[model samples]
Target: MTLYNNVFETVRMIEKEKLDIRTITMGISLMDCIDSSGDKSRQRIYDKITGYAQNLVKVGDQIEMEYGIPIINKRIAVTPISLIASASGEDNYLEFAKTLDKAAKEVGVNFIGGFSALVQKGFANGDRILIDSIPQALSETERVCSSVNIASTKAGINMDAVKLMGKIVKDTAYLTRDRDSLGCAKLVIFANAVDDNPFMAGAFHGVGEPEVVVNVGVSGPGVVKCAMEKVKGEPLHVVAENIKKTAFKITRAGQLIGNEVSNRLGVPFGILDLSLAPTPEIGDSVARILEEMGLEACGTHGTTAALAMLNDAVKKGGIMASSSVGGLSGAFIPVSEDEGMISAVQNGALTFDKLEAMTSVCSVGLDMIAVPGDTKESTISAIIADEAAIGVINNKTTAVRIIPVHGKDVGDTAEFGGLLGYMPIMALNKFSSEAFINRGGRIPAPIHSFKN
Candidate 1:
């Protein structure tokens, strides 16, 4: 591997820009694991996951150690259980989720996504069942994640599913209210969501992939932020170039590990998602990168412009680095996960409205944010609607993982602990969207929707 004298500088950049491989997710398809009998199908599901992924975490650790690059998470995303709809009865969805959770825990994986249903156009019986069961399933499981695809560039947003999800989010929060509504933390509603995203709670093995493949997600928001600090209010062009250069180094680190892991595991190497995935850690923050880029605070008036530039530059560098780069390849603005961002929100420097604006350029949507527990379900849906609209219109992927902490209101803090971090619930606009949102059938695809 080529080496450089800028190693320490690179690490400093990584620390500030939240630049690290967010996740190295192994996608394992289990379509062939279905059987006519329920018991046999259950066993097939477990065995298939275990047999395919027993070595995932172990191998990932080895790769991380050898490459000297941190792999923040090693996980597995499977074909959505809804695909094998006939294997289990509608009422039996929980068991399937249990089986998945079991296999994930046995493999030493933190989260296993793909307990999903694709309803961009419409829903199936199985999809409906899984959707309905999400609150219970998530409340009961330790590591299972659920996502619903309600919109896409071609199909537009699904208001029906979005409404259902709002209720589900509320219910999940209620069920886990004592635990900070963590069950809701495992859920996301997406528009144009990627099938091969290595990040959760939205990641799921795309149906088009091989039986087993490894995709890596690398982040370096800190790296970029550090670079921006060095430039210190240089012209916008220079700032963008600095971001690109920092991204290049981070992508190189991801490439080094991704290739080595794929080779060791004898699986096809997949995409390198060069997203700026922040954590609660002091230095790892996408928001901090923006702050370093001259924003007084991340949720301020200038934040969106800063984030948009940062997002575009990272993509430029990552695209140049690898042919397989994919997923939500932009700065992720998860409030709770970034100590700086959470503080910004708590201090009234960041607001939910500004957060929505930022998602237009960010990788994920409204992630790890906290709101009033009693906030209307329709308001939650409105938040989802806003994000889906941006994604659909721009033909890009966007998603929401908002957590309405039960019994908590604006300015009150809610702690999720660990990497999820503690969040201060930001105040919501008291205005109602009921009149506008209630009339929804579909937000028609954007004017740029023309493919021909």
Candidate 2:
């Protein structure tokens, strides 16, 4: 009866709540694909990715059908292209991006990541080339997503990369202006970026990772919010306990799906990322989970404290349920992706500064936010710098996926469509960070980061 009750409850969670496997990402290493000839290298990359991930989407669909679990996306993450393409001595990496896009389409994955460079401390030869190509690469490719790690806890922050990324972001927005700067939505700027993350646009197969592996991302924000409602008048400790238990259940389901997918593909199962990633749908929100914890609104005065508790509880529960828990394993608070977050921003309950504070506890940083079209590049860089500092000092991964939608402003909304959703343009400080950003150099690692 106990086993029967658990199975019944899980089924109910999937049916009534928006419980789902967010993505089953196949991480493919491209190190062996490198060649002296750029054409040859691209061909190798194309063959390797399509070959490894060809059965990925099909396997994901099969699992969803068999287990009655919703698998929202089937995706792929590859080794950073900078390392792979540098061997070819290519001045431009545009072809590399196109090859990835083509391969992703061939395999039918929703998104293909790792058009990336890791320059947390400084730029390598290939890192600069890849960074230079990002504007055109993202603007030209349909499925290719890009990321640049400009800061880390040990290596500190690369102010040069930070400053350059500001311009790169603006250029991407301008190039994709026909689609409301949709290209910027596919780009992420990071600090302490992890390798095994199954979610994009920050997902990449790290050098240390196995040649081919399967990573899973699971989400159940609506299930969590529903659980919170059950203990409406409960104490904070009680609320925390309930969240932990719910997270354990969610993570278990994710691991089951992940292991099955890995087995079917004949690849090792990687970590299960149990992030409570939200969608545009109502009742599916991290903000609502926080609000259900007795807050008047999502971004009220005690929001950060609530978020800290929630993040900690979720991690604790996930760790208990799965030994292979990795990736960004906490709650994600992307404004465009969460209906509750969008409502909070529109009602003036959430502000840009509050979002920054929230990132200190949440999974990622300043994700899927759309700022005014006229916002200055230096100001955007400054925003990245601030988020980087938080991640570096705290030794946690943080990323910025802000989009400055072309011809849009505070009173307007930018429609990105699908899971990318839509968001109102949020206001930013008019004060300039130009002079600060112009003082380009690396910010030294924190004192704590010096420990061996």
Question: In model 2, which runs have C-alpha deviations exceeding 4 angstroms?
Answer: none
What digit string (tens of lDDT, one per residue) describes model 1 on residues 8-123? 65655444445566788999998887776667777888898888788888888887676556777989899887877555664558888898899999999999998999888777
For candidate 2, the TM-score is 0.99
User: In candidate 2, what are the lDDT values of residues 1-452, reduced to their tens digit?
Assistant: 99999888988899999899999999999999989999999999999998999899999999999999999999999999999999899899999999999999999997999999999988889999999999999999999999999999999999999999999999999999999899999999999999999998889999999999999999999999899889999899999999999999999999999989989999999999999999999878899999989888888799999999999999998998996999999989889999999999989999999999999988889999999988899999999999999999999999999999988999999889888889889999889999999999999999998887
Model 1 lDDT, residue 389, Cα: 89
What RMSD, rounded to one decimal, does every model reach? Answer: 2.0, 0.8
* lDDT, model 2, position 41: 93
lDDT of 2 at 249: 93
Model 1 residue 344 lDDT? 91
